[model samples]
Target chain A: MIELKNVTKQYPGQPHPAVDSLTLTVPEGEICVLVGPSGCGKSTTLRMINRMIEPSAGSITINGQSVMNNDPDHLRMGIGYVIQQIGLLPHRTIAENIAIVPRLYKWPKEKIVRRVDELLVMMGLDPEKTRSKYPSQLSGGQMQRVGVARAMAVDPPIMLMDEPFGAVDPIARTHLQDEFLRLQKEIRKTIVFVTHDINEAIKMGDKIAIFGEGKLVQFGTPEEVLTNPANEFVENFIGYDRIVKKLFLYQVQEAYRPAVCRLRPEEIGNALSKMLAEKAEVAFVLNEADKPCGYLTREELEQEETARDADGLQKLAARRSKAFVQTTTPLPDALSVMLEYDAEYVGVLKNGLLEGVMSFKDIRRHVYRREGE
Target chain B: MKMSWERFQIALFEKAPEAVLTHLLIVVITVALAILISVPLGVLLTRPRYRKFGVVALNILNILNAIPGMAVIALALPILGLGIKPAVVALLFQSLLPIVRNTIAGLLEVSADVKEAAAGMGMNQRQILLEVEMPLAMPIILSGIRTSTVYVVSVGTLAALIGAGGLGNMIIGGLALFMPEYLIVGAGLGAIMSIFFDRALSYLEYKITPPGVRAN
Candidate 1:
């Protein structure tokens, strides 16, 4: 655990402290994202944890030991740090960059080499192809991945990441964020993430600490902060789209309703009867093993008057790739899949088996019910 | 013309071979000493507390640089009392400005992000300076050394004025005796040496520059 007690950082001439007397505790194996507008001392607080920026007053302890007791270099070596610019040493190849800490710790040569290749693979880069390439040779996304890989080279238990994905284009940023999230699930390192983008905070933070000026205005789980903002500033910071943003925090499985009308590809008459009796808009067509094969809309079913036709509902079903969403997909993504395919609903699948289906109506109802409460 | 060529060969191979050797020796020693003194002095000036002192030191060196090489040698003559010693000292002072100024400039040109990353990654101040800052600043610093080397070689000719044996002796002696061959041999060899040293250092600069930062 990382704990700060009444930490304050006051510049010599500045009237207000850059970071006021603030205290925060980050539990083991959790990500605490520090977020606010520019110059709110979010970065200051992060630097203080590693002793890069010493606080004027108060104590900081990592893993229950006072940070002051350790040498700054020794302390820093034990913590991973990544920044916005992805500061990989331009002169060094990707492998050398990743080997920095491990080499610093005086690991055996083979061990360092092994770790470098391991981290490259972990960051989704092909080690043999990338190990010898310099930072300048890589794209912005690749450089950012290498930056993260370098930070994790020594497997430091705590990581301090300051807007690590801020420099990439939106498409690459999303890709990097997904890869990092997947990597984080496996590593489970205690991380202190700093970002100003609220959506990013909601997406990656296990708990978000909202800062205003030099003080933390609110610190809570994304659900708590979104559902019950501490004050007007936080509410304003979260913006008017908080309701919709909350949907990103929920998975498709959480809001999906069991399909009322599901039918095998051959059972066209039964499919039509179920759609009619249930007044459903779409009927999911299943294959022999009960996996979602395609879907048929009531409009298409009505046009096909002959239910006993050889092709039956199978021919009428639209096998759109966008119609499929996994159970683990966030509701916002599921909604986007619906919009992308121009479909009324999306099938939620687990291991190729149809668990249920979700529509905009289901997400809206779920979000609205939470809002009402 | 044939007589001048015969005289030039005799002057270069027999009469003044020692002058040529001494001239090369003086240039090498002066440049080596200038590099040893100025590179560290340049690095020292870049430190935050010493930065102002560095500016003041550079200004003093700039004044020294502005002075004519002959005048600097003349000034050194009275204090050190002549020969290769005072001449070497004057040339050393003359070369200081380029190496010092270029070292400071090269170090300063390193991006703030690179330094922060070095520190954040647990590199101490010395490691950051050596492994990160120095390697990045090398191309610029080597350029400075090249300039200093050329200056030292050209100025070493002036050491002959204070009874220092160099190619300058031939030029001075040839003018007095009206021997055009002596002048050509001295001036010709000096120019060739300057070009040779400059090219060598330029090659060094190219080789030491990090591949990622090498100009296209």
Candidate 2:
């Protein structure tokens, strides 16, 4: 855990403090995002934790010891730092860059090499191809990966990131964010991430600290901040589209209605009867193992001349081409899939078993109810 | 008198071998002194506090460059009067501008991102300078050194004016006596020496450049 108590930073000639009596605590193995507009001291607060910018007053501790007592270099080595422009050493090979902290600590040559290769593999790059290449030789996204790999070289428990994904294009930025999120799931380092993009904070942060004019205005989980903003500043900063943004915080299973009126493949007459009795437009068709097969709709049942026809139900039932979303998939993504496929309903599967179903109406109702609350 | 290839060969290989040695020695010492003085001075000039001083110092060196080589030798003659000593000092001064200027330029040109990275990774000030800044600045520094090497070799010929021995002695004698063989021997050997050193340093520059930074 990293904790800052009443931290303040004032530049020599500036009229006002850059960061003022800021206090924050990042729990072990959780990401705390520091977010605000430009000149809000978000970057200043991050730099102080690593002693890149020394605080004018206040105490910063990692785990339990005050950082002021530790040597700056020693403190920094144990805390991984990444910046907006990834600063990979151009003169060094990728392997050498990743091995910097290890070499500084004088790890065995074989061990450093092993660690470097392991990190390369973990970052999803081909180790053999990338080990010898230099920073300039790699693409921007690859360089950013190498930057993160280098920071993780020592496996420092605390990682300080200052808009690390800000330099990449939108598509590459999203890829990097996803890759880092996956990496963090396994490593679970205490991370203090700084970003101006509120949406990124929502996506990546377990807790968000909102800064305004060098003072932290509010700090809470993404849902708490979005649903119950601290004040007018946060509400405006989160913007008018916050309702839609809140959807990203929810998963498909969280709001999905469990599958009902399900029928076996051979129960065509029962499927039609269930649809009529439930006053539902469609009934789910399930195979013998109880997995979703397709949907038998009222329109399809009426279009068919008779339920007893040999291939009647099979021919009338819509193909099982409706998109399948995992239960863990976020609602916004699930919603997009619905729109993209022109789907009225999507199957939500958990471990290959149809746990529930989601439709546009259900999503709208859930979102409206949440907003009302 | 007509030029004779045999006499020229004799002058180059046997008769004036010491003069050739003296020419090579002068070029070596002068270039070495230039490197020793200018490289550190260049690095110091790059420091933020000293940057303004660097501009003033470079301006003075630029003024010195504008002066003719013979005039510098003549100016040195009054203070240190004669022989290889005065000529060496003059050539050393003459080579300073390129080496010092280029060194400062090279160090300044290193990307700020690379330096910030080195610091962020926990490298101390000295380590960042020696390990990161120096290696990145090397190719440009080497190019500067190459320029100085060529200048030193060609300019060493002027040493003969101060009663210093080199191929210049033969050229001066050949001109006085109207002997084309002596002029051909001296000019030919000097040209070869300059080209040889320039090419060798150019190759060194290519070798020392970091592979990642290579334009290719």
Candidate 3:
């Protein structure tokens, strides 16, 4: 747990601290988003933790140990950081960029190389394609991936990302945000993410801390922050669309299976028959034991048949080729996957096995429930 | 007896195929040396605690820069004793201020946000300086170097007054000898090098320096 006990920061001759005696704690394994308008001290509050900006008053403790007592270098090595511009070293290759923290900690050369390669792949980059490429050659979205890769290089327990997705275009930004959320699930790192976007805060934050003019105006879950705004500033910051925003959060879950659907070789015929009988046109193909397989349409089978020799067609066998989700995956993500694959449903899996299927129909039903409440 | 201006002029151009090369060499050497020395100093001076001291140092350097070239050469004559060293020393000192001052201005011109982004990414001070700050400051530094080069070319003519050999010695020779061609060659070469050099350095500066590091 990271705790900031009434931390404050005042520039010399300033009338008030940029962060004013604000107190907060971010529990382990949670995403705590700090957000506010420009100059509200959210950024200052974030920077103060790393001692990039010193707090004028109050104390900061990481897992109950005072950060002030430790060398700032040691304190920073254990924390991951990402920034708005994605702060990549322009001259360095993606691998070397991610290796910075490990190199700083004097990790062995082979270990640094191994860690860099693993993180590159974990951040969804192909090490072969990206490892040697300099920062300038990558797009905004790719740069953010490298930044996230760099942050995760040392496997720090805490990650600090300051508007990491802000530089990318909207489509890329949304995609990156989803990828970031996915990474958080896999890593389960305690994250302190700062942003000014309410939608992002609602989507990613387990807890939201809203700031107003150097003071923390509200601190609560997204539901509480949006539905029960602490004051006029927070209400205004959250805007009048709080109802719709809240609805989007829970509505996606309703649209379908938030679990992985997989089909094995033996179940392929049965799954295909179900789609044909229901006239669903497209069905998710789950493997025999039930896991996410790719979407299949009768048209795909016909195309394959026409392309093959008659003898080959007679010998053709059915197999489930795709696996998709784990339960607890966000609705927005699952829905997008369904939409992208042009399927009516997706498979939900828990652990390595398939649990159930979620259809668009099921998702609508969930949305209806949220609306009624 | 004093040597005739004709022979004095020969010492100036002794190594030159044409007398003009003596003046060209003096101007070129002075500007090059100034650039080599001042840009780093200028960049170093703009740092936090050093800013005020940097400004004051620049002011003093500028005062030195403004001293009459002939007077500088004359002042150096006693210690440097009537040769290329005194002439080159005077011109180099005079050329330093503009290049150094402009280098500082250029470096300070980089956006603060860019610097902060570099720092927050776990870059130590040296990394930020060598990687981000210096690259951004290069264009401005080059401009300073160019400005000083042009100034030093014009000042090289004054070196001849103190018996420090250069094309200026030929101009002085002609003035004493009433030989118009020698004066024309010396003065013409100095003027030509000044214009040619400013353009050349400006071109090199533009061609080589990148717009900026992608802090975005």
Q: Which one wins on lDDT? A: 1
Q: Candidate 2 — which residues are off by over 4 angstroms?
A: A276-281, A288-290, A297-316, A368-373
TM-score of the second chain for every model? 0.95, 0.96, 0.84
Instruction: Work out the TM-score per prediction.
Output: 0.95, 0.94, 0.72
TM-score of 3: 0.72
Output the number of the DockQ-best candidate: 1
DockQ of candidate 3 relative to the true structure: 0.20
Q: After TM-score superposition, what is the CA distance of residue A255 in candidate 1 from its true location, in Å?
A: 0.7
Model 3 gets an lDDT of 0.75
Interface Cα RMSD per model, in Å?
Answer: 0.7, 1.0, 3.5
Model 3 CA RMSD to the hidden true structure, in angstroms: 8.2
Candidate 1 or 2, higher TM-score? 1
lDDT of the candidates, in the order given: 0.88, 0.87, 0.75
Give the TM-score of chain A, superposed on the true chain A, for all candidates in the order listed. Answer: 0.92, 0.91, 0.72
Error of 1 at B53 (Å): 1.4
Ranking by DockQ: 1, 2, 3
lDDT of 1 by residue, B1-216 (tens): 335677878888886778778988898889899989999999999988799898689899999999999998888888988788888998898998999999999999998988888788898889889988999998999999999999888888888888787988888888888888888888888898899999999999999988888877
Model 1 misplaced regions, further than 4 Å = A275-282, A288-290, A297-316, A319-322, B1-3
Per-residue error for B175 in candidate 1, Å, reads 1.2
